[model samples]
Target: MPLHHYLIVAAALFCTGLAIAITKRHFIGILLGIELMLNAVNINLVAFSRHDPEKLSGQLFALFVIVVAAAEVTVALAIILRVYGRYNTVDPDEVNDLKK
Candidate 1:
């Protein structure tokens, strides 16, 4: 109902995402964390845009962010799949070198 409430939720989601990104060893897990952070950002943008009816810049930016995130996930998943095929592992720490 209030902006602060949204802000708090976004902050929590961002913090959780950051923690996940830092603690996860798997590439897919890290990607999930990044996606969570992006969603949190979108929440903030939408919440702010709700306050301003004259301009929809925040909402527009959020939409752009969604598109970017979608593209990012697509590219990332493709790369991850390739890496797994080549390395036979999804753990980033295990893949010290890109060369075979």
Candidate 2:
């Protein structure tokens, strides 16, 4: 496949993720959107790196991003779990203050 094809797919995925993030009310939904966006970025990175045989910078950067994204999701899920326990809700809009 061509680089442009990958770019188009990534762009679509990114736009979909952005829309999801903006429209979703639930914490998990927002997380899903973020993950989608990250994956789209990874696709772009890999696509760009494929043409270059001398250097693997883009692929390496994508790997680092995946690791970072994993850690971020772990921390975010932990925070979301705590918030749900305290407030009994997963809707971000419902949780305004930290105080009980």
Candidate 3:
């Protein structure tokens, strides 16, 4: 397969994820969007790494990204659950407690 094809798919995935993250009102939905974007990045990294002649830096970077993403999701979900316990909702726009 061509490099451009992988890039195009990555672009589409990233755009869709961005749109979802911006439009979604629920915290979980936003998280899903973020995961989508992360996966798209992984695809790009792997695709580039396939063409590398020396060290597989792109693949290594992608591995770190996945690890970081996992940690982020864990922490974010914990926070989201805590907020839900307090406010009984996950809509970020509605959580205006910071203004107080």
Measured by lDDT, the strongest candidate is: 1
On a 0 to 100 scale, what is the lDDT of residue 65 in model 3? 93
Clashes of 3: 0
After superposing candidate 1, which stretches have Cα over 4 Å from the reference? none
TM-score-based ranking, best first?
1, 2, 3
Candidates in order have lDDT scores of 0.95, 0.94, 0.92
Writing each residue's lDDT as its tens digit, candidate 2 over 35-55 gives: 999999999999999977678
TM-score per prediction, in order, is 0.97, 0.97, 0.93
Weakest ten-residue segment in model 1 by summed lDDT: 46-55
**Over the stretch 5-31, how does candidate 3's per-residue lDDT look in tens digits?**
999999999999999998999999999
Q: Which pairs of residues clash in candidate 3, taking residues 3 or more apart in a chain or in different chains? A: none
Over 4 Å off in model 2, which ranges? Answer: none
Q: Given candidate 1, what's the lDDT at residue 42?
A: 97
The alpha-carbon deviation from the true structure for residue 66 of candidate 1, after best TM-score superposition, in angstroms, is 0.4
| Residue 15 shift from truth in candidate 1, angstroms | 0.4
